[model samples]
Target: MNERQRARRPGGRSARVGAEVHQAVTDLISERGYGNFTVGEVAARAGVADSSIYRRWGSLANLLTDVALTRLNARSPMPDTGSLAGDLRTYAANVAREITGPDGLAVVRLAVALSSMGQQGVQARDDLLAERTRQLQSMLDRARERGEHAPDAFAVLDHIMAPMYIRVLLGIGPLTPEYVDGLVDRLL
Candidate 1:
């Protein structure tokens, strides 16, 4: 195979390179907001040639979109505790813990900021929200199948997640277990 073909091969090194690039993207965004960095900086941080990133991600916005998608995909799988209340509580607790962490909060903040820019941001935001919505809906659907009188998935999801996002974005009160319990109770 030619050098270009070898370079494009996916394997351990490619996976490592992708992970490093993603980590660098998150760290850079955390250190210096989303709008202030360049692909060259990310390339340097990832210890890869700038052309590698360009070849892989195409552009800065595309790279950021991939970062957002990767962040969302890395979250723990949705819980299944046999009961809607139990599931909601578990999900809320997990989300609360994540949103309060430095890396998680940085990803969330950057995704939100990027959503306002243009097409790439909008696509990333949509993909992220869609995945989240799908997970919540799946949990609610399982509850419905198990004879629980669940409300509309989207409405229930809004009630549960909106407050969490508010806290994450606005620096509101802590996401205590009591708070999650209250939200779950109110939803159910």
Candidate 2:
């Protein structure tokens, strides 16, 4: 096998290091909140050299963006249950669990905090939102193709997702199954 093939292999040292670094960021954010630590601190927590993070992710904003996006993608996969209503409920429930999971709030906070760190931070936030919108659009498009009545992706964000996120962000309430389903039902 060539060097590129070996590098592309799953569970390689690179992947392990990347995962460790991401976890370190999450832990730090959970413990001390965003902007409370530095890249060096993250490296120490991950047992990696600070230069490695710089080499891989370029900047702290970039690294934070990567962590947020990676966690979001890894957790909330777009659901497809044929009916648009079913898909929205399932997707919202998946998201509810994700945000309420052990590291979910930390990752969510990381994404929120990224918005105020100046140009790079704002750009990262935009990238994260764009990725989410693109994923939702795919599901909505599938519904449209099937001749089902589907609301706009932004509507899903506004009606279903934004409420859940705000509830999680503000510690307003628990995301019960009924609540998630209700959001979907109201949207439908």
Instruction: Flag regions of model 1 displaced more than 4 Å.
Output: 1-11
Each model's lDDT comes to 0.79, 0.85
- Which residue pairs clash within candidate 2? none
N/CA/C clash count, model 2 = 0
Instruction: Kindly report which residue stretches of model 2 are placed more than 4 angstroms away from their true locations once superposed.
Output: 1-10, 101-104
lDDT of 1 by residue, 1-188 (tens): 86556655787887889889999998898789887898999999999999999887767877887787666656756899999888888887887888777665665566667776688767766766687678778888999899998867677658877788778788987888998889879878
TM-score of 1: 0.80
Every candidate's CA RMSD: 3.5, 3.1
Local accuracy of candidate 2 as per-residue lDDT tens digits, 59-116: 7898898888786787888988998888898899998898887665765666667876
TM-scores of all candidate predictions against the true structure: 0.80, 0.84
